[model samples]
Target: MSMLNIPLFFQDTAAVEGDMGMLWMLLSGILVFFMQAGFTLVESGMTRAKNAVNIAMKNFLDICVGSITFWLVGYSLMYGDTSNGWFFWGGFMQGEGADLFFQTMFAATAATIVSGAIAGRTKYTTYIIFSLLMTAVIYPISGGWQWQGDGWLTKLGFIDFAGSSIVHSVGGWAALVAAFMVGPRIGKYVDGKVLPIPGHNQILATLGVFILWLGWFGFNGGSQLAWGGDDATGASTVVLITNLAAAAGGLGALITTWIWYGKPNLAQSLNGALAGLVSITAGCGNMTATGALLAGLIGGVIVVFSIEFIEKKLKIDDAIGAVSVHGVCGAWGTLVIGLWGVDGDTGIGLFNGGGAAQLGSQAIGVLAYAVWAIVLSAIVLGILKATLGLRVTEEEEIKGLDISEHGSIAYPGKRQREFEE
Candidate 1:
């Protein structure tokens, strides 16, 4: 049932199902909002102590800045009356404010994903501008291509259950371009070799991972967008597969790293869990339990290799592995739907006799998102690079963004001497 048919207004009391969906969606949006805290903690904990305040500020402002801009422009671009084209101006839309709030959270998430990629050295002013642009223009326009009722991709039957390719991969592609434009963190690459710059707070990072895990329940679950009868049952099933896949992904990463590096690393394990979550998101509604597990396991292993490849070969400096966990794994989840999605009113995977057609559809959708997101981000960041500059000066970077950018330190007493030294 299309949300358009559901009467969400209180005056339309006949629509009990819409009311249930509204409640469920509100709960889910609240949960996803908590993910900002998770992203903040992870970004801060993973980077140097000197930049913790800067990272925190970026995450917080992503929500504050992202919400208002998306409200004013992004929602209409995504969910308004769209033309039947690849790109359409959705125009200023008026709908349920509650639904708008739910989508705004997702917009914030897409913008926030880039924060980790360009963590250490980006200018705060430049970031704020980019965040607003991304939510108001980049993300929403791309989103319109899929989610809008009259968009071309929807006509072509591209499926993204909860935005694996739509939200996560869009952010990933932008991150890839933005990180390339910003350059790596200072000392990340000296001479020819890629050096390891481990995060400062593993415990805090671990806690952040746990919080993200909890929030994903809402992320994937509420995406069902309905609540009565079969919708409720399906939502519970989605929650189950989501949890199982995450577990499997963590285990897969743990075992792979243990076998390859000779130890089970916590950071890799946490990333693996996230990898699984991203991997399963596109197929959460249509996949069987076994399929979800396999997809997640594949996602976990894929992130390990993808991270190394990006670091060593591509030489992209992603501080928190956002590119691998969200971008690479998100693509996997979307593609896997072509391989194993159930046949019904929902979707039909190739493995279930849907044929190569679905796989072809998935590929085109992923490629389209990559090209569109990367090109737009590169253009925006390139323009910014030529004018405002992307990275901080060497002296400011050495002093830390917290002091250089914000004139304050996250841990003034303990780190002041070390920073001076």
Candidate 2:
């Protein structure tokens, strides 16, 4: 029957459900947006106190500047019409306002991940330019490859349920390139001996992790897109698995650090939780609870070793372990789907009796994202380095970016003499 002929009750019921879905989506986006604060706190707390304000500024920029860029063009690039299965130019704001809002947060997240890795030494202006490019161009193109229904990776059956590779790894790999280009913080490596530069406040970092853990419910669960019908169950399961993975990850890291360092290390344990979160993000909608736990456990363990290797062996300075937590675990999360993924009653992973095709597809997607992120990051950062410069001067490095770049301090009247040197 036509809408005009339909009963008011029936029409109201249908409209209510639709409205509820919109509310869920927008709320989830808000939760994800709050994660910027989590990121800021984690990064600032993990670095020297003098650079805390600078760290805060970078994160603020990620959301503020990132939202505008995404609204203007990034959203269109990611979800617009396309026949070539690559990307599209659907003009400005071509989709639903709610979708654009949700995706804007993701774009900001991809850009913010880099801020933590290059925390102590990067220039503010250079970071601004990079953030704009990342939110506007780099992340959207890669994201379209999978999230967009018409994209090639989507056509190939690549499964990244909630962007382990699309969002986290893209950011993670970009972080790797940016860190390498900017080089290590002063005194991080002296004459081949690795020096430990403990964060100014572990408490803040710990709190930040808690906030991120809370925010992740929205990150993974919100990806469900609806709250009625089977969507309610699906979103709930995603939240449960995400929590299980994060808890398992924290435990895994805690245990590994105790064994390796002969003591329980809080820092590694914190990152382990995040690593587990990243590990399960790609497979959260596909894996069983057991599979998610195992994946998270392995991800937590992997992060500890990856952090050591990057800092001690590879000699790269990732101030907050972003590369290992996001990049390495992101790839692992994507691959885990091919090993334990399930589609209702059907098993799709190799260990679950499915063939190797899904595994192969996952690997290809992982490799593709890595290469694309690395190459583009290198080109962008390289140009910025040669032109506007990437790092602050040696004098500014010792004095801190807060005073040098912003002409303000996070905490006033506190003697930074100890932190400056």
Best by TM-score: 2
Q: What is the TM-score of each candidate against the true structure?
A: 0.92, 0.94
Tens digit of lDDT per residue, candidate 2, span 1-421? 8867987776878676777788888999999999999998899999989899999999999999999998777877887574322333343342266777899999999999999999879999999999999999999989989998888898888999888999999999999999999999999999989999899999999999999999999999888877654532478889999999999999999999999999999999999999999999999888888999999999999999999999999999999999999999999999999998887657889999888889999999999999999999999999999999999998998999888998888888777675576
**What are the lDDT scores of the predictions, listed in order?**
0.86, 0.91
Q: Which stretches of candidate 2 lie over 4 Å from their true place?
A: 1-13, 82-95, 229-233
Report each candidate's C-alpha RMSD, comma-separated, in the order given.
Answer: 4.6, 3.2
Cα lDDT of model 1 by residue, 223-323, tens digit: 88755436413678888989999999999999999999999988899899999999999888878888899999999999999999999999999988999
For residue 111, model 1's alpha carbon misses the true position, in angstroms, by: 0.5
Candidate number of the best lDDT? 2
State candidate 1's TM-score. 0.92
Q: Among all windows of ten consecutive residues in candidate 1, which has the lowest summed lDDT? A: 84-93
